[model samples]
Target chain A: MNIGIVGLGLIGGSLGLELYTHRQQTQAQISNNPSASPSPSYRILGISLEQKICDIAVKRGVVDEASVDLSLMSQADIIFICTPIAAIAPTVAKLIPYLQPHTILTDVGSVKKPIVENCSALWPNFVGGHPMAGNTQTGINAAQHHLFVNKPYVITPTANTPLESIKIVESIVDLLQAKIYHCQPEEHDRAVAWISHLPVIVSGSLIASLRQEDNPDVALLAHYFASSGFRDTSRVGGGNPELGLMMAKYNRDALLRSLQSYRQTLDKITTYIEQEDWQTLEKQLHQNHSDRLKFNL
Target chain B: MNIGIVGLGLIGGSLGLELYTHRQQTQAQISNNPSASPSPSYRILGISLEQKICDIAVKRGVVDEASVDLSLMSQADIIFICTPIAAIAPTVAKLIPYLQPHTILTDVGSVKKPIVENCSALWPNFVGGHPMAGNTQTGINAAQHHLFVNKPYVITPTANTPLESIKIVESIVDLLQAKIYHCQPEEHDRAVAWISHLPVIVSGSLIASLRQEDNPDVALLAHYFASSGFRDTSRVGGGNPELGLMMAKYNRDALLRSLQSYRQTLDKITTYIEQEDWQTLEKQLHQNHSDRLKFNL
Candidate 1:
């Protein structure tokens, strides 16, 4: 079996490394055991637009082979398009001709509904997969082995998607050592908007608000006084502007609803502070605390 | 010289341990060097309403002596009233009769303006001090030495505050190995409102809004989908409700203004998303990212 990974950034490079390791281990295990099936041996082929990334992926042993040509992916039984949200559709379109009759294609985009809608219509084996793992740093340099260990990897499959395609992607997720979650494309998009994309907007807006402080002295003092709370709350907001924009663009309606819902929650909290209703405010805060505790993830 | 710490909570207990260590180190240095001044020898006397706390503090070598009686504070040349914000003024009022004429009094509270105004009016030697160091855990068991090391310690002094009192507190801050920033009580409150308290409100509201999601599937899926982004952004919001309430109560006006500013920022971002203005959204996010990078702390 030949595995293909395109766009060797953080996610793609990490996936290549993990898959290669898993494939090698499986082959060794099959060799050691007489009853084990040795027919389905896997090899990883990595593709990147930049020759530097392809060279690094090969030098680092992230894949068995890497090239700058899309045609190299024609031999791949399965391909993971690990590009940014805005580029996923275009990248898939360019690779369609390289896909074999038995080829199954998946993606590691953050947003799913739009990608799934566009890709599943274009190819029978296109499965929308979102590996919910990332880092502060980007590119091949930031990639490492076991980056997706124990992280949630959501596969948003439409009704038209073949069961064989999902099963193939499930095996890929298993190779990466990540937990698998299955949902419709729309449901996955909305769920992520609440837990992932919504945080970006709210966190970003907070720093933006702080930037509006006209008093230079207050701003300076704020810098000195800011501690763990501000650092944590502002982390996602201040990360990856292009990614944030893509999340907003692709998941527009759900993100807007989240922002509006968040606005209402803020207004209610503000009113409690304004009216000096300490009891209600404390009760509401207690509720929030408990609600957060319900989700350990 | 003697140092007194009232209330054996996280800050108070940690202060006791650190001060005791510093005092012993200085005494050792003076004894070892014949030329070093030995006149300003210091001892730590810890007072707690609970006799159990006093006994533990002494047993743990957190202080030179421990007592339940306020009269023991008479020997305290400098006293740190490290109690809850609501209890600070009342605790100070009770400690006044035991205070010597040369004594310097301060408290470690998050919101400084209200406490400073109340305590400074009642005590001639009162100085407002806020040590910007804490943990999620509370009480004496959570306390450890070096908690204040390299942390910001804000000293807010008014026009009426004596230079001697400010000097005394500054020395204590030095002993804790903390950097001190001098500001008015109101300025400290306003600055923290932006950097610290505002984050609590926004973080808490994000979780609260997620709790309000009517669709049970979406809510359940959100929990599964939630990752580091949600965890980080919601950390302070799900923290101690009483502390959150106290911050809201003590710094009402400033917090209200921060909430308003945050609301406007959220609205503008929401409009950008609703209008599908990806350029403006990306620009705003880039601005937030750079703004956050300006302050390393």
Candidate 2:
């Protein structure tokens, strides 16, 4: 089976490596166990604007073929558009003309609603997906085969999405050894707005507020005293500016809703501090502590 | 030389181990190199509310002796009151009756102004200290040597603080191989309010907002989808509630100032989002990213 991956960065490159590893493992298993049925072969075709990255992906055996042409994706049985959130729609539009009717389409974008809407309108084969796994690091250099292992792979399929396409995407998720979660595009966006996008704002504002510190000495000392807590909380906020902007742009309304909800909670905490209500504040923190444990992810 | 440590939890227990290791290293050096002057023989006395923890500290070789008696600290040349912020003042008050005039006192509390004020009033030899090294884990079981290695150890001394007391604390910091930063008590509180206390509020509110989610499905999905970003950002918020409460209480004014600053920055980011000013939002995030890099902690 021919698989096409667009935009060979962290998500794309990691997916390519995972697919290649799965194919090799399956081949090994089939040879080792004669009773096992032969698994279909996989050929990964990587498409990227950076020809240099494409060359590296091919050299690293992450992809069987590398190309700058979207037309090459026409031969693929399935295509994963791993572009930035803002670029997903345009990339889908560009690839639609070149894709076969039977070709299965998906994405690894953080926000799913807009991408799902645009792709569902253009191609019935598209199933919106988001692999809930990433690091502070980016680019092909940060990519690894185990990136998606044991991670949550969310599939957001609308009523218009075909069952066959959803199943194809599920099979790919199985190969990646990721736990699959099915939800609507709206649900996926809202959930991500709370868990993913909201944190970027919270963390970004934290460091940005430090920048606003009028006392240079205090600001300097803050930098010196900033430890694991500050580093961890501000990790996502200090991520790629373009990516942060894209998440804000693509999921603006949902993110705004999250911010509003977040503001209310923050205000509540501030009020508790202002009123010297340590009991209520401690109770609230305890509840949040218990709730955070429920996430376990 | 005798060293006393109160509250044998993460900070205190680790300090015990570090002191023990340093003494052993110095003894080894004295034996190997006759040219070097012999260092004073050392003893570590650990005190805790839990007798089991005290026993464990002794068994683990974290301290030379463990005692439930506060009077045992009278034999110490220096004492590190590594208690909670709320307990620091009272602990110092209780220990003051049993402390020797020459026993230099210090603390590992997160907040400093209140501790500095209370301790300096009761004990002329007290030097306010906060070691910026901790994990999400707490208690003696989580304690390990080298916790303070290369970590920031801030000494907040007021005008009334004795120079000899500061030097005593500096030698201990040097033994731990931790970097020391000197500031006033007010400055330390403000710096910590920004770097430490504010992050707890930001992270706790984030998880709390998710609990307020009207849609159970979205909330449930959020649990599955909460990635490393959400985990990292919310880590400190889910920490010990009593600890968070203490930080909020003792450092209330500084924390309130930090909250006001944080709210303003969050409001600005919200305005940029509301106005669809992606360029400005991206620029702010870019600046934060660069500023975060400067910390390198």
Candidate 3:
């Protein structure tokens, strides 16, 4: 099946590579203009949306092909909307006129509810998806052919989302050799908020806390001493700040709720420390130890 | 030079195995008696400390005959006080009479200030040392000869600390094939508070937050969805909680100060989110991105 990928950045470019590796040719549409460089803004485009360069690369056999028109997506059997959260709505709105009734639509967004809510009605064929795989690198240059190998590809389907379309999307994800899991749109947001969104804030807070120290030596030393544990925790936080802020904005209620729950947990543990209740603290540690054993990772 | 290890738990036992592999013998004292377990209600007899274990083991041909010791660590060229943070102070107090002036004393506690402060005045032969190497496994059974290989062995020496004693401890750490660095008590505490202690709390907070969810399905799904990043970040939190709590409690002032600093940083970023100040958020992310780049990890 022919796949149409929008944006051609990390998510987009990676998806293109994965699709091609699966022996499916992809028709990619990069929306930015190459000759007219935009301001170095917070948009994902600054990192990935290279239309002209991508077009040249595609012409030179870097990719199968590239286009600037949304109509090109009309002929695609499956279309993956791999754009930023803000751009997803507009892109979906524009593509609605040309999106085939039977075409399977999916996205690689971290937050699923907003996009799914906004586009599910616009395109009855849409199935909200998030490939739970990413690296620190950005842009098409950072895209790897096997980046999605063995990663979880979450497919969030609403009551209105056609089962056949969900299956088609799953098949595409399977073709990339990614495992697929099913969840509701709201569930997807809450899950990502707990694991992905909260970590960013926590890690960012860690970095910011060190920055408050007046002594540059201490600040520098703290940074130097940060090990793999600190890096992993802070990985998502050191990502695009604008993207982080946007994620918090888009999933504000869920993120806030998660943060509130998290604050209570922190307070409880802190109180235990204050009271010198080592027994209760040990129980809490046991709970985490038992809980963490379930995941293969 | 023969070494005496007081406790045969994770740190102590690991040290024993490592010492044995290097063909250097160490006398170990472990409490084999069930009574001397962590709980006060448990029995307290014959809890073979590393010193005792190594003594018997060496005599029984479990190790070289050259390694043999009991109460008097006077024969020990150096004594490694490898025990829990809570046990470090009192144990050292009890063992001080046995420590000769030339016997270099060191430990592997996560917190160093209290340890250094407690022993510096009490034991003239003491030198505060923390081998920042560890694994999830504990006890003598988990001991490996190479546990300390390539890891940082932080040695905190006071202003009044003798230079010869410091060199002796450094040479011992070098024999273990670990990197050695020297810092003041406060500096060591603050550095560990940022890298080791702080990550534990943040990770525990994350685990506790996820556990608070009343929805069983979401909790189960979260367990399934937990990734390598979560595992790495939460490793310290899921560790021995009593030990974690003690580290936080012993280093309470530094940890509390760091936590307050962390919360304030989080508040600033949360405010940015509440107000949708994406520009300021972006700048902070860039700053963090740059700051993170400075770290070796």
In terms of DockQ, the best-performing candidate is 1
Q: How far is candidate 2 from the true structure (C-alpha RMSD, Å)?
A: 3.1
Residue A33 miss distance in model 1 (angstroms): 4.0
Report the CAPRI category for model 2.
Answer: medium
> In candidate 2, which residue ranges exceed 4 Å CA deviation?
A1-3, A20-35, A38-46, A50-67, A73-77, A99-101, A134-143, B1-10, B24-35, B41-67, B73-77, B96-103, B136-143
lDDT, candidate 2, B1-297, per-residue tens: 799999999999999998888788888898899777776588999999988999999999899999988988989999999877778889988998888778899999888888888888988788999898887788998998889989889998888788987898898789898999999889999999999999999999998988888999998888878878899999999988887988899999999999999999999999999999988998998998898899976
The residue-level lDDT of candidate 3 at B297 comes to 74
lDDT per residue (tens digit) for residues A75-145 in model 3:
67777788878888788788778866777777888888888998887777789998988877876777777
Q: Candidate 3 at A296: error in angstroms?
A: 3.6
Error of 1 at A77 (Å): 3.0
Quote the true-contact fraction of every model: 0.87, 0.90, 0.51
TM-score (0 to 1) of chain B, per candidate?
Answer: 0.96, 0.93, 0.81
**How does residue A27 of candidate 3 score in lDDT?**
19
Across all models, the iRMS values in order are: 0.8, 0.8, 2.2
lDDT of 2 by residue, A1-297 (tens): 799999898889899998888788888999999788787577999999988998999998789999998998999999999887778888988998898878988999888888888888888789999998777678888888788888899999988888988998898889888999999989989998998899999999998999888999999988888878898999989888887898899999899999999999999999999999888998998998898889875
lDDT of 1 by residue, A1-297 (tens): 899998899999989888777777777888789688663578899999899999999988788899999999999999999887778889888998888888998999988888988887788789999888888788888888889998989988888898998998898788778989998888888899999999999899899999878888998999988888999999999998888988999999888888888888899999999999999999999998898899875
TM-score of chain A of 3: 0.82
TM-score of 3: 0.81
Better of 1 and 3 by TM-score: 1
